[model samples]
Target chain A: MSERAQQLLEIADDELLLGWRNSEWTGIAPFLEEDVAFSSIAQNEIGHARALYELAGRDLGKTADELAFDRAPEEYRSAALVEPRFVPDWARTIARHYLYETADQIRIEALKASDDAEVAGLAAKIDREEVYHRMHAEMWLERLVGEPRVREALVELWPKALGVLGDDLRPLLRERLAALDLPEVEPVERGKHSGELAELWEKMTVVRRSVPGATW
Target chain B: MSAQEQAFLEYVQGGGQVETSDWMPAEYRARLIKFIEMHGNSELMGVLPEREWILRAPTLQRKLALTAKVQDEVGHAQLIYRVVEDLGKPRAACLQDLIDGKSKFHNVFHYPTKSWGDVGVIAWLVDAAAIISQKALLKCSYAPYARIMKKICWEESFHILHGRDVILTMMNGTDEQRTLVQEALDRWWGPLMQFHGNPIAQGDDPSFSWRIKSQSNDEARQQFLDGYVPQIWELGLTVPDPKLRKDEEADRWEYSEPDWAELKHVVTGNGPRTKGRLQLRRTSRAETDWVRRALLAEAA
Candidate 1:
């Protein structure tokens, strides 16, 4: 209901959806060590969502679970960028992963300075953990940079990656991308849901919706 | 078989620890891979039975814990496969062998999990059986596998605690919840009994001969009983075995014989849920194949 609550919800929704999408690779990632490391990142994303939901829930009169699983598909405030189930496609997954972490880093930096101290504090903590994600993503990005498939995938997904960061942060994101030697591309932008979100929401909410009144 | 191998064999028989680059006969290397590969397969296959539960977990805590648990299984698989890799087999080859069903995993993982109760019982009892063997592996001659076992055993300690907490909560809940736990135990009893494998003599088992398994099959089963049976009894849940008892003089557990033929059938990939579970793994891997090829240096 409050502006702060809405802001938290959108960010939380993005994280929850992205976390859900990323976890699809839990058992099937390319390598075992990376699989473990990546799964931890996915869990942490969901964790961030939960903590954000908890903060947002206090004002909305809802629990974190209610906020996470109780929402209808269209009611979700996640960006389209974080919604796809790109399980088996390492190229697209990494492109999206590299892009999202970049966008998230930019956004979290802004959140870290929010007027709500708790919001700012939590964002700061999350940003610290994202450092590893960035390292891991960048590691893959560097390795794949010389490869044609990864480069092509990056070019194709750049616009959507740009869309993840809001207009206010575009200049800074662009500046950062340039510093990293990445070429310019249009962003897919926030506020729109990708086709992937609907399917993800369906599976995610299925169990929680079943026997709704009973505690698991 | 040779005079040198005979001496090497006697050393392991006397509790000698063998490192990776240490002197070993060809037989020891083959036996090591067989035992450890099965373990790696067990961890990888183990993920399937519990993964669906992550989707169905009732609460955020439950979802997170279950997901982490399953994730840990994948991690364990990775860790295990690395050890196997060091033992002269490539990970890809090991995976190839696994999907082909040319190797075996533990029996408990082959059966279907019926309810949330099954999940708890598995995390509790199955992991308990595994930990008994794993703790023994902490002293294994294979340094790499044994080193990894320390981490595996430490992490498993948490899994068992989480499992015990889950079981206790269900048991202390409503009648329906209690029934869920009891029903799950009944269905799982046979598999749990067969978990440590048939009580083969340590001397006759090559795994034991190489000091790869410090405890005998029967010894591991008895330890599981000794550690967990009382805990089960205190919770007021029946183990479904009428002859289940501990002999004070022999210090051995006596229970009705587990269906060895059934254990053989299930582990060889013919349990009721084996094909379906393996099918899921096959499909998911196929679906995710591009990711590996795209990212892995060697695969690329």
Candidate 2:
């Protein structure tokens, strides 16, 4: 794959997996209003992934859905941060939400400076939606920052959150964490698939794989 | 009825609407709460069956669409629970009653969704059935619910289109895919027929007398048949009912008597999947109790 295509897939895979993880809270969020609000955020992530895949598909000669779903779990370039399930655990979920959006802002800002106009344009579009996601996460963080469980969740997931961006972006993520009084931790790098991603892949592709070569 | 209560009934019957500040007869308010609360409960419980498909939707488009559809149901539940809340019962109490099995949702939600075909059938036909009843509520005497139904019905139209798209694509594919739709339709037909509840004359039903529902149980069922059966048959899908037919002479549909017994059994919380779904709700609620507390404390 071209370097640009590979880079696109990496970000697309992250959004796809993160959206899938977040959507698990659709029906069962702590409250109804939050449930609706959170699901919209999940949909926005998937939408961003689809647009990224479509751009990458041009280089790879594949459809967006093919790039998104047809790959083996091992081939996925998503970071470990998004692979874990967080349902029924609002504290951890919000921790991941706040951290991922923070890290993602750094990644997206760099992409917005890409030489390729298509990539830069898409990055701009995604950042616009991410504005709401950031506000949502920050709102929750403000509300629950004093709670012990929220603090513990942030501390535990800090390393994985840093892993979402590259070394160049990690410094920026650290700067944001410092602003929030979050402690810095060692990074858990990507390039490895967790068992949880495998399980998620199984459920995600079950119906599509049931009858191969047939349109859903 | 007391003279005052009779006048209230007459007012509602004469196209009058009630707001939160209006004075209503105690019985009307109580029944209205129960009825509307059940609608809210159904919208919430309805999410369970569909959310399973959100994770399993066959393609990225399917996945996103299914997730949004489920999200809309949750949104509807929120809107409905707000209406219920204004009517006196709080949202938490309604949710508590639902988990306790002391309240009822619609019967269709109690059954299991066994396949992707079930997803299409539900999004297509199940939602189609619901839209019929909801459209009647467009004239609901409670103006708040009536207004919300307008939005709900608009969203439901998109769901039906999405569902039809799913079913049609499958039906146009391999024989195995067609079999999936047929099998799902067969299993769901009975519940769909029973969905609007047992037949009752419009004038005799209290909900009708108060203008909460402008249509009777059978009228809604007939409308569902009139609208959907032709579409189903045009696609070469069987109705799964040997006796289902419209009698043009009477302008009504006649079919095998729906298993009223099963409808009763299910809505009373004895369907095949009722216990498990409710238990899932209970467990999730308990797990998230602390989050609510933190929010309340922050607000205070």
Candidate 3:
């Protein structure tokens, strides 16, 4: 794959997987208002994924659906941080949400500077939508900061969170964590897939694969 | 009825709206709480059947659309439960009643969703049926609920369009895809027909007497049929009911009567999936109980 296409696939995969994970909380989020708010964040992530996939698809000569659903499990470029199942666990979910949004902002900001106009334009659009997501994540992070369980969840997921960004971007993530007074941890880099991704992929692709090439 | 109660009734029947602080007859207050609480419960429960599909949505666009649709339902529940709270029932109590099977939700939520077909059918037809009932509630005598219904109806417009888009896409695709829509329509038609509730004479229905619901149940059902049946037929799909058709002379759709007994059984918590769904709700609520407490503690 071209460098530009590979970059798009990596970010698109991360957003798609994270969005899928976040959407699991739709009906079962801790409270109704949060359920609605969090679901919008999930939808936004998926929307971001779709745009990114479309951009990549233009390069690969495939449709966004083909990119999103028809790929083999190993072919996906999503980070491990986004691949876990976190439903019914508000603490971890919010922790991941908070961390992911913070990291994603850095990535999106860089993408906005891309030499390719299409990538830069899409990043600008995504950044506009992501404003609310960052606010939502910050709100929850503030609310849950003092809770022991949430603090513990943040501790647990910190390394995975760092995996969402590349080595070049890792220092920025670390600096942001330092600003928040969160502890430094070794990064869980993204080359290897998490065990959860395969399971998630199985469910996510079931309907599409049930009738191959059929419109949903 | 006492003079004051009769006056309140006459006021509502004459199309007067009541605010949260207004003087209301005891029965009106109680009935309004019960009626509105059920609507809230139905919206919450309605999320369950469609949520599973959120994980399995075939395309990114469909996934996002379905998530937004379910999100809207949850948001509607919040709006409705807040209204119920103002009417003297706490949201917690309403949720407790729902979890304990001490309250009712609409029957459509009590059933199972078997496939992607079910997803499209629900968004297209179930939401269509719901929108009809909701449109009628625009003039609800309770100002708060009527106000929220306006937003609810506006949001629902996209759901029906999204649903129709899904169905139309499948219909225009392979035969198996089209079959999915037809099979789903077959499974869902009965619930759609029964969704508006068994017809009750406007004068005899307490909800109508209080102007809580402006239209009769049958009126809502007819509106759904008139608007959607042709859309279904044009797609070459069949509703499960063999006798279902519009009567030209009566200017009404005539059909084999929906099983009111089944409707009662389902709303009363005996449908195929009711027990499992309630259990899921009970368990998830317990799991997240601390999040609520944690937030409340922070607020305090």
Candidate 4:
């Protein structure tokens, strides 16, 4: 794959997996208002994934759905940060959410400066939507600041959260966390899949594979 | 009724709308809270059956569509609970009543969804039935609820289309796929038939007497039949009611009397999936209680 296509696929895979995980809370979020708000964020993530996949699919000679659902588990390039099932675990979920959105904003900002106009333009659009996500994350972070569970969750997920970005972007993530006064830790970088990803992939693709090539 | 209550009733019956701040009879306020709270509860409970399918959606589009549809239901619950809250019932209390079996939701949601075909039938037929009733609610005497119903109805239009598309794709596919739709229709037909509740004289129905519901239960059921029975038949799916037919002379639908007893039983929190669903809600709510407190707590 070309570097550009690989980059797009990595981001797309991250979003698709994260969106799927986030959606597990649709009907069952902590509160009704939060359920609605979080579901929108989940949808937005899936929407971003679809758009990214469409861009990557063009270079890979496949359709967006083909790129999204037809790939073998090992072929997906999503980082491990998005692979865990955190349903019914709001503290950890929000910890990951806050961290992921912060990291994503940094990555999206860099993409906005890409020489490729399509990538840059798409990045700008996605960054616009991420504004709300960041606000939501910050809102929870403010509220959960002194809570021990949230503090503990942030500590546990910090390394995986760092895995969401590339080596060059990791320093930026570290710098952003420094503002929150979170201590630095060894980063759990990409290039390794959690067993959770394989399990999630099986459920995600079951129905599609049931009637292969038939429209759902 | 006192003269004050009588006068209030007359105004509502004459198409006057009530605002949240307006003086209402104690009984009127109580009934309004219960009715609106149940609607909110129903929307929340309705999400459970379809949520699993969002995970197992066959395509990216279906996944997005299902997620959006479920999200709308959650949104509707928020809107409705807000309306109820403004009427003196807090969202927390409403949720409490629901979990404790002190409240009720719609009967259709009390049952199980066994297959992908159930997903289609529900979005298509069940939502079609609900939209018919919701359209009637656009004229509800409670102005806030009526306004929210407008938004709710608009979003629901897409759910029906997405549902129909799913059913059509399956019906037009292989034999097994078509059978899926047929079997689902057969199973869902009973609950769908009973969805609108038994007919009562509009004048005698408190909900209609207060103009909170602008149509009788039978009228909503008839509209559902008029609008959708043909659509179902066109797809070669049977509705499982042998007696179901439209009476051209009276412009009414005649069907086997839905088992009111069953509807009563199920909605009273004894449906096949009701207990389990409630437990799921309770467990999830308990697990996340701290998040609510932490996020909503006043700053120190």
Which number leads on DockQ?
Answer: 2
lDDT of 2 at B236: 86
Q: lDDT tens string, model 2, B68-143? A: 9999999999999999999999998999999999999999899999999999999999999999999999999999
Instruction: Name the runs in model 3 displaced over 4 angstroms.
Output: A179-185
DockQ for every model comes to 0.43, 0.89, 0.86, 0.78
Whole-model lDDT values for every prediction: 0.83, 0.93, 0.91, 0.91
Tens digits of per-residue lDDT, candidate 4, B230-285, equal 98899888878889889999999999989999999999989999999999999999
- Scored against the native two-chain complex, candidate 4 gets a DockQ of 0.78
Worst 10 residues of 2 chain B by lDDT: B199-208
Q: Residue by residue across A5-44, what tens digits does model 2's lDDT show?
A: 9989989999999999889999999988888888899899
lDDT score, candidate 1, position B2: 97
TM-score of 4: 0.96
For residue A71, give model 3's deviation from the true position in Å: 0.8
Best by lDDT: 2
Error of 3 at B177 (Å): 1.5
Error of 3 at B167 (Å): 1.4
